[model samples]
Target: MLYNIIFIALFIFVIYVFYKKYSKKAKTIPPHWHSILLKEVAFYKNLEPSEQKRFQDRMMQFLAEVYIDSVDFEIEELDTILIASSAVIPVFSFKEWHYPTVTGIIVYPDHFNEDFEFSNKSESRRIAGVVGTGRLEGKMILSRKALRHGFSNKTDKGNTAIHEFVHLIDKMDDNIDGIPEILMQNMNAIPWLKLVHDKMEAINNDKSDIRAYGGTKQAEFFAVASEYFFERPKLMKRKHPELFKMMAECFRVKF
Candidate 1:
């Protein structure tokens, strides 16, 4: 009876700990932040009031969990709001989804070089955003300017924050070669491959609306197409129905 009593007590303790942890995580956001999201992010503005509330909830959860800090420029409310929105948009369809591999986000004042090391001799190319790997895994870097630019205009179908996070998501399957293994069923793999190849070929031939960057590689194609999928759903659907359907299935979101 003593052993049974100890086990019950331990279970109750674990439940209590989890309850408190979750309750603390669900803290409400300030009204001003909601206003900022509405004004700054087109995605947030397009959501219904109820959906807006849900988005805010998810944003708050992300802010609470993710360590967002600035490198050179002072981070503002809008920056965090928009960054969190970018993270939320891709996985918004799944209520319980969270970016497990992404532990933190670093925002630089502007685009940085490949190694991001400031040295006159280093010949690194400037880039907007990059996902961390190797020893620096679980981290992501973004340009503050690019973060704002993503929300400032809704027509470009390009978002640096979303682009990098999609790369992170693509990495979940132990491969970042454009195939999202965990989310896609085995039966759909071949068709997905064919579509990726054909569309990439079209982009190479300049016969596709997908950015030329997508023609670079399979992984780049997935990330670039995802940008179009979320940012310009109508154009994507009208122009390329099959690619749109594939994106929809990959994300489980219609738009």
Candidate 2:
């Protein structure tokens, strides 16, 4: 009788603790921009009404669950981040994963320089014009100017947020390669590599609108592809039909 009573008490205590944790988590709202205008900005005007509604709900839920840190920016500057986040929500709707590992966002005034230690060699390198950086476990650093430039330039085929977020996605498998697990699961690695190789060859032969940065590595290819996927979907579809199809399948969205 005594043991039964103690066991019941322990179970109740565990349940209480879990309930308290969940309730506390539920009470916290996501970080928001200072002005209402930032919240109102919409980047997906081209989406259908039904799709837009769905995306809005998902974005709200995502924001509520994920922590966002906005640094040293006026209320208006935050509008771009809000709009970009809202726009990308639709791309994630097909997957069950709602949140990324990234919890913090560090924003700079403009493009910044970063030093990197080479993995293969005992050498240090410096890179300039760094717009953004995304870590595997929920940390992102970005430049405000780069963010604006990414969204503002429609024809440039460069998107800093998308690029960083793609790195975050790539890190899901604890690998920084361009191939995310979702794409790898659905497509063969060999074919993906072959396609990328062919594309890089074409890009090198003549500068395609895909951008020169994409030729740096396979990981960069994924990031660059993500930019085009969202920015120039029609062009990507027209130019690389199969690759575009694969991206659509991985992201669980229709072009």
* Predicted structure with the largest TM-score when compared to the true one: 1
**Model 1 Cα displacement at 208 (Å)?**
1.5
| Candidate 1: worst-modelled 10 consecutive residues by lDDT | 117-126
Q: Clashes in model 1: which pairs?
A: none
lDDT of 1 by residue, 94-115 (tens): 7676676777898888777877
The whole-model lDDT of each prediction reads 0.84, 0.61
RMSD after CA superposition, every candidate: 4.6, 7.2
- Deviation from native of the Cα of residue 15 in model 1, angstroms: 14
Q: TM per model?
A: 0.86, 0.71
Error of 1 at 134 (Å): 2.4
lDDT score for candidate 2 against the true structure = 0.61
